[model samples]
Target: MSLTKFIEEKEVRNLIDNYVDKPKFDLCAEIKANPQTKSYALVGTAFDYLMRFHFEYKYSIIDNCHWVAHNSLVYLLIDNFKLGIEPVKPIAFLTEMNFKDIYNDSILDVKDLQEKLKEKNDYKGRQIFKVINLILNAEKEYSNFLKSGNLTDGVIKATIDLAKIDVIYRRKHYPNDLGEYKEGNIQDLKQLYKIIPDFSKKKDSNILLNPTFDKASQLVGGADCDIIIDETLLDIKTTKSLRFTRKYFRQLIGYAILADISVNIKKPKNLGIYYSRFAKQFVFNSDIVYETDEYEILKDEFKKKANKIYG
Candidate 1:
């Protein structure tokens, strides 16, 4: 399919609808290299609705600021810090910290910081996006003001928004709480998942591959992780049990194998599916964790059996 067609396809809905997910794995899975959705409201029927609506011919595309990836931004920050731009905003609590504090953190004297950075041998004076941090600080300030009272924009009140924040950090605890805990947590994990060791490799054989498993039959593409690489396909899912569902693990196993076949890297020896289960933390004993290699086999065995279903 053409790239545009793939983006607009309604069949994509089948992914979240059919796949299962419920529990969450706390480990920082690597980027393929490691990383880590479904809902059934009427929104689930959106694909059906869109098919019948004859919308206007596309005009200008929506203004989505597809800036650099978060990791890239972070890398730039680190580099800028070395250069003295120090774009890395200190870990300031938003709901707790005020505008004055943020301003101080950003820069007490911009000219002085700039001059010092200019003379430093840190980066040969490359331009940096020092402004983004300022914008984030501003966003945090606005978010904090909004949370000061139940009122929103002085016109509308957002029970849902408040509810989401309250769940993450109660009203008393949430400051500039733009769900930073979750985002910061993801950032903090980048180091923990520095390496993904212990996985096998496989080569692709077009002549030997079952024709039915061609690209046309491949339903999932980049649904998880920043980028899908060989030997590691990270998908986020929520499941009641974290145990192996090897009996019906063919599709995912195929993902690992397919990623291996297509990429030069090691066969994704691991398929990490992350899910969030609401079970109490006290019930830790009930949690199930399966090995990546074990799931790989479960997938191969299931594929052998499910081939009959397709036939």
Candidate 2:
């Protein structure tokens, strides 16, 4: 079980119900979505990727290159090679070409791709969209040259062909949802970029991208939080709904307790939900949300529950 699944367990829900309190915040004016927009999940994922890209371009931070698609590809490869299950045509073609070895080797090449992207010195929406696709495609098409003993020209041709198929495959199965991949999603990201505050201006702020709660994450199988600016942990939400639900509140509280127990950076002083559509953040001071005594008690209870459930 992952932290997400663990938190949804009945016992954990009961703990949250008993301890967590919803914070009050004024809602921002809504930025309506395009009528033709299909999948909010894709939009959310893309927006999250774009925000990470934006931060890298705007601030001084090392690229983490923590693409969630890598995990999806790993599982797909395992199913194909280990379990004797056939995947979609594009994926099947990849597996047939001994792409598993390429996939293993390409993990190290993400930094090279990041360097190439940095050389372009362009982080605009179109460039970002293309680069994001390239990264998601695993950046292993070049390995076809060595595998097939093909010349540069043949390798370039094969790479383009493979890339096209890969994009088609991803649009069908990425996030395991049905939706058309549209240019409007990129446009939405551009609009979101306009609203992002310049974190570089903040005094003595430290930014950790895709921060994980070390041992706490290990205990629950795996868990990663979004950007943490200074002492604030922010979860980006691309949902159309404006209401701050109890579900969201509990997720933040869960993360806070995990952070406290994990041997990572200092626990967040505040928890925030950044609603991307409205470009608004609803923040709650950690102290106000959980009093000192109550927070310690809850944290201890959480650790015991996590060990019993996932340890």
Candidate 3:
């Protein structure tokens, strides 16, 4: 069943309107300082930031790497098409095959991108080319859907097709490369590509809420959520399986609590983890839903823990 339908009435347009006066905090700095000492505290910040990028921005920060950049660009392209919206910013492609200086100017042509990918003779180059080809070929297979497709149903078939391709090549090219710093990111694309259509078709506009909330340095610390779809709080886990472990659950619940105290918005009715690699969503409703009791408990726990490190 589509869990999203159950939480429609609980969503609010501006979740932060009531608490505009809250003070802000910059937890990113704390997360960067000697992670060895406060690893647990940092984990929440790190995961929250990563999900914000993946869910809200639809791009990964680690995509700065060339190998990962290819996937990021392709995903961005597909997302734009699926959303029935044009790219908000112009996208640039590398003019040369040199990994260091691959980009020149932003070009929106898929064929031009493919042409450039073909020119590279190196192993990494070939790897990128193959992934791009997978997307291109998938696009061709689903060209029909792209024709009359609204934001609702663009091309889910192509996603499964790409998943079936053997794109995981020998690590001859950048074996040590951390594409998006998340394992199975390339493989997980198949799942993300397939699942996004389901979200777009929902009653909500699928708009991303304030991706970051650095405005709570006063009563509480800074906090952010992954994807605020309508009234749901969704986080993406690129992990191969759905492991709602305590640490993971705490991290998500922390975001919910932070969202409530900092933004004065009612806690989300639904919380979801999109296990991208598995192409499945493990959703939690009333059972694990954030409430004032849980919120106060977590708030005290977080502040106590965060203060130990920050102080």
Question: How do all models score by TM-score?
Answer: 0.23, 0.67, 0.39
Question: Taking the tens digit of each residue's C-alpha lDDT, what string does model 1 give over 1-311?
Answer: 22112323343223212333323334432123122212221111211111111010111111111111222323333444532223344222222221211334544243454454466535323322333333344344334543452222211111112222322211122223332223332322222222222122323211111112234233332211212223234332223344434322323434444443343323444454432231111111111213333444543443443343333
- Tens-digit lDDT string for candidate 3 (271-308): 66655434456666623434334445545554554454
What range of 10 consecutive residues in model 3 has the weakest lDDT sum? 1-10
Q: CA shift at 304, candidate 3, in angstroms?
A: 3.4
Q: Total backbone clashes of model 2?
A: 0
Worst 10 residues of 1 by lDDT: 48-57
The residue-level lDDT of candidate 1 at 131 comes to 30
Residue 94 miss distance in model 1 (angstroms)? 23
**Model 2 per-residue lDDT tens digits across residues 1-311:** 66778788898888877776677766767665432366466557656655665565556644243445434443443443232223222222222322322444433233443454466555332233343454434334334433443333332332222233333333433332222245565465556656776655854457887777877777776677778887888998887777788778888888888787789657899898888777778888987545755766777888888889765
lDDT of 2 at 229: 83
What is the C-alpha local distance difference test score of each model? 0.29, 0.59, 0.39
lDDT of 2 at 287: 79
Indicate which candidate wins on TM-score. 2
